[model samples]
Target: MLRRRGRLPAAPWLVAVTLSALLLAAARPAVGAAAWCIARSGASEKALQSALDYACGPAGGADCAPIQASGLCYLPNTLAAHASYAFNSIFQRSRAAPGACDFAGTATVTLTDPSQLWIMHLPFISKHCRAIRNTRLSILHSELHV
Candidate 1:
């Protein structure tokens, strides 16, 4: 007769997998929630300024705390900068709903995360790229040999 192996308890493993999934979901940005600012090339300067004013004012319904003096996002202190913050705040708070990012043609919604652009522009991005390339090469080499 063949010997049978005993089974281990599954509760702990199930809990661990559930926790990992929740953490991963929390770490990622909300789907379709990415925000775009009006301060881009070819946008009308006057319209952008007006949109910023409204976004920061009570009419726009955005929390302007971060853009205030001495606030975390207060630096740069330009109209476009402040407006971008306000517009993004509103867009996120609204759960990225349809028309949430449309600031009277001053702004548009984008699927790409805006923070990724900042990260790419950082001085250390090249180092990160090299590391990723090296990792990919290692994986490819191993796969080919296998």
Candidate 2:
């Protein structure tokens, strides 16, 4: 080991490296803390519909094509289902920015996998699961692998 009589030259570099590491860690999501946004359970249908409209509207700019009449996610045909999808879409598009999932308090964030929970709630999952469109599933699969 080499010792310097005066101040060490590496002090600045060490500080910079420490700061860079802290910044990168702060920018990243917490380990094993996968998060998703969903419509709040027990919210009135009217409220859910309103939030859904906002989520699908220009203000929210969420991809709502999946919830249309002929869309893959239309089967459930419930306000909660539609709202959940819309809320999550906008939440994700916003990169989960603060208040992105609020929807006037009709929406919330969850650590649970909302997509899986939604699928489980579908009545026809056992019989018609294959018939449902897999666009979202495929996208999720791609993302997980990446």
Displacement of the residue 99 alpha carbon in candidate 1, Å: 1.0
lDDT of each: 0.63, 0.73
Where is the poorest 10-residue window by lDDT in model 2?
122-131
Total residue pair clashes for candidate 2: 0
Residue by residue across 1-146, what tens digits does model 1's lDDT show?
Answer: 44346643577668988999999998765765544543443557798878877877788887777567755456556665666667777777777767777777777655554546663221112244346547877999999999
- Cα lDDT tens digits, model 2, 44-102, are 88888888888789977888886788776676777776787788777777777877878
RMSD of 1: 18.6
Deviation of model 1 at 80, angstroms = 2.3
69 Cα displacement, candidate 1 (Å): 2.5
- On TM-score, the candidate that comes out on top is 2
Q: Which stretches of candidate 2 lie over 4 Å from their true place?
A: 1-32, 118-131, 135-146
Clashes of each: 0, 0
